[model samples]
Target: MTEAAAQRAGRDAEAAPSLLYLVKRTEQAVRARLDEVLKPAGVTALQYTALTVLERHDGLTAAQLARDSFVTAQSMADMVRTLEARGHVVRSPNPVNRRELLIALTELGHRLLDDYRRPVRELEHRMTGGLSAPEVDQLRAALDSAWRQLN
Candidate 1:
């Protein structure tokens, strides 16, 4: 290769940020902040996410919850078990499908979510504290587009 081409390649390799690295780093940072914020409530970030999903759409099966929460079915099963033991959620046999178990948030779960709403919202606001509203929207759009690209 020519000297000019070799230099350019080295510069490109050193200067360009990996998209995967950036995404993973951002996720880690967010999760760390969420863990700190949610610790007092005795909920991990994944558990909180699952609870939020259940709050939005009650009566989801464990497998469905796993899909929605981006976790493995086994992890979801364990989480469901924990939630059930804590009385935050209950599972019942699906009437339409006896083989499937439908999971629903109990009244305690609803109340717990209500308690978490403000703190989590504040944490989100803090995460985007530097961004204007428009910038936040743009960031969301860009991230969503990137996510869609993977599919």
Candidate 2:
């Protein structure tokens, strides 16, 4: 290949946005669409995700759930309060740790989650439309590696 052609190729590559920028933009688009789809259910995606985590790890503290779900403690606290008001979550004295309160999904919480679970799964797939299974796996691996490298 001629030197001029090689230089032109390098310039074209440099002119394109980095993969990280595209990934971040795509993530934002997914979040925006999810939030829109979740609006009618009267629950944000974050709230629903936290509830899912609580379902998986029943009787978890707000702190524990926050850490597991990658959310802030204050955000979890707010969600718990909202869920409690909606009759979806029950906060009780921690049996093992009296000093801190533990949160659990009430029977109502489980039912409500069940109702929304189908739509949630559908929305997730829709948001990730056009991505193949292997492509999704590659994205996951890349993100996990990036997170570990950064933190």
Candidate 3:
């Protein structure tokens, strides 16, 4: 084969989708889309995820937030520090365990989350616009299973 033909053949072979490739690509696209939409509001996707978790389950320790947010403890600490500095989160001594610090969303944090709700929902709608509700559920289940298998 000519060099051009050889390169085309290689590209064709790599284009055959695998679950891993598809998942990674989807994650990248989703993150990019979220970042673009959230930039004006001043939060990255990871920061938004941390905020969302805290909103749902308040008063979690830094370590717990790290696990829930799928981030390293060090990164979570940094994120928490940044959020606290921005007045979006507050850290207090865990009453039950004085050694650990429990983090909670401040009123500002709640306000920020509330502000993003509509945009985030619209983004989700756009993402799943092609899929039926059942398919969306199945996709969620399959992804959850895959995550459980790996972790």
Candidate 4:
């Protein structure tokens, strides 16, 4: 190839965003959508994620919830307090670790999740609407693999 053609090709490649950039962009878009969808429920996307994590693992420390919910420990502490104040979650002394309190979802939290289930599902469907079932499966696998590799 001519040197000028090769230089143009290199510039074009450099102009394209990296895979990681695309992945993070997608995450941002999803979070924005979640914020809109959950706004009526009076919950932010991060809070909803924490509640879901607690739903899956009933009792976890603020630090654990923070890690799972992709927030800082301080942020999780604040969130726990907010959720508790809202009667969506409760904190009790951990039987295994008396000094630490475990956060758990309350009945109200579960109901909140149930109420938003359909909307959340619809959001997910919209995300993958362009892909075939097999392609969706592959996308999930690929994303999971990437996560596992980094994690």
Candidate 5:
């Protein structure tokens, strides 16, 4: 290679990946691990996320659940249908807002969440195995701050 091209190549080799790239890769890895852990229970990582949100805050609108689950409204609509069909969630008309329906976890959903809680915790522990607790907290805070800024 020409000297200029060689210098450019060296710089490129020493450069770290962008934060966006690293974050995407980390998300993919987490999703894959969650899928592996949840597959036996017949739930996707996304579905599990929605269920967990409901476990914490019951009777949220579909849009609210979608936002909490980090999915699009349309995607949440379909997910709600599938989850409802599978007896994981149910939708009922909002008592205060008759036109809007609220989604809530079913008994089966609670049971499934309970069943996978330990495995999910183990997955998180494994993912943060090398990081100290403070580092993990820092990572979480950084990510949350980035997300808030982007939003």
Candidate 6:
């Protein structure tokens, strides 16, 4: 490479701000904190996300849950197995689709979800703690718009 191009590349790496990098870094911090909170209960960050999906959309298939959380079906299936073994979820034949299985949170899962509710809310509060409600709302809307545009 030419000297000028090499210097420009070095400068870009040193000073450029990447939106993708910022988003991933913030997500990693939040995930680390959440994992710290959930680990005591034998829950992983990925499992917690699966549980959150079940809470929002009960009776979702493992495939559906995977899609909801940006995971592969195989990974979600493994998580569902772990959750099932822990008595936090149950899997059954999909009522309408004979070939597919449906996954749902058990009563134990519901109770566990209720039990750990505070930490998740606390995490969100911490994430937006410095912002006023209006600012938070605006940020949310902007994020929603951007996500829709990109995705």
Ranking by lDDT: 4, 5, 3, 1, 6, 2
Give me candidate 3's TM-score against the actual structure: 0.86
Clashing pairs in 6: none
**Candidate 1: tens digits of C-alpha lDDT, residues 1-151:** 9999999999999888888888899889989998998898788899989999999999999999999988999999999999899888999999999999999999999998999899889988998999999999999999999989987
lDDT for each residue of candidate 5 in 1-151, tens digit (9 for 90 to 100): 9999999998997796988899999999999999999999888999999999999999999999999999999999999999999999999999999999999999999999999999999999999999999999998899899998999
* Candidate 3 Cα lDDT to native: 0.93
Q: What does each candidate score in C-alpha RMSD?
A: 2.5, 2.4, 4.4, 1.2, 3.1, 4.3
What clash pairs does model 3 have?
A: none
Give the TM-score (vs. native) of candidate 2: 0.81
The Cα error of candidate 3 at residue 94, in Å, is: 0.7
Q: Estimate each model's TM-score.
A: 0.89, 0.81, 0.86, 0.95, 0.88, 0.86
Q: Model 5 shows how many backbone clashes?
A: 0
For model 6, the stretches where C-alpha displacement exceeds 4 angstroms are 1-14
Question: Which residues of candidate 4, in runs, are more than 4 Å off?
Answer: 1-3
For model 4, the local distance difference test gives 0.96
Ranking by TM-score: 4, 1, 5, 6, 3, 2
Q: Write the per-residue lDDT of candidate 6 for residues 58-132, one digit (tens) a residue.
A: 999888899997799899888889999999999899879988989999998888788789988898899999999
**Which residue pairs show backbone clashes in model 1?**
none
Error of 6 at 16 (Å): 3.7
Q: Cα RMSD (Å) between model 5 and the true structure?
A: 3.1
Query: Where does the lowest 10-residue lDDT sum fall in candidate 2?
Result: 29-38
lDDT, candidate 6, residue 60? Answer: 91
Query: Which candidate would rank higher by lDDT, 2 or 4?
Result: 4
* lDDT of candidate 4 over 9-122, digit per residue (tens): 999999999999999999999999999999998999999999999999999999999999999999999999999999999999999889999999999999999999999999
> TM-score of predicted model 5?
0.88
Better candidate by TM-score, 3 or 4: 4
- Where in model 2 is the C-alpha error above 4 Å? 133-151
User: Model 3: per-residue lDDT, tens digit, 17-134?
Assistant: 9888888998889889989988997889999999999999999999999999989999999999999998989999988889999999999999999999999999988988999999
lDDT against the true structure, per candidate, is 0.92, 0.86, 0.93, 0.96, 0.95, 0.89
- The candidate maximizing TM-score is 4
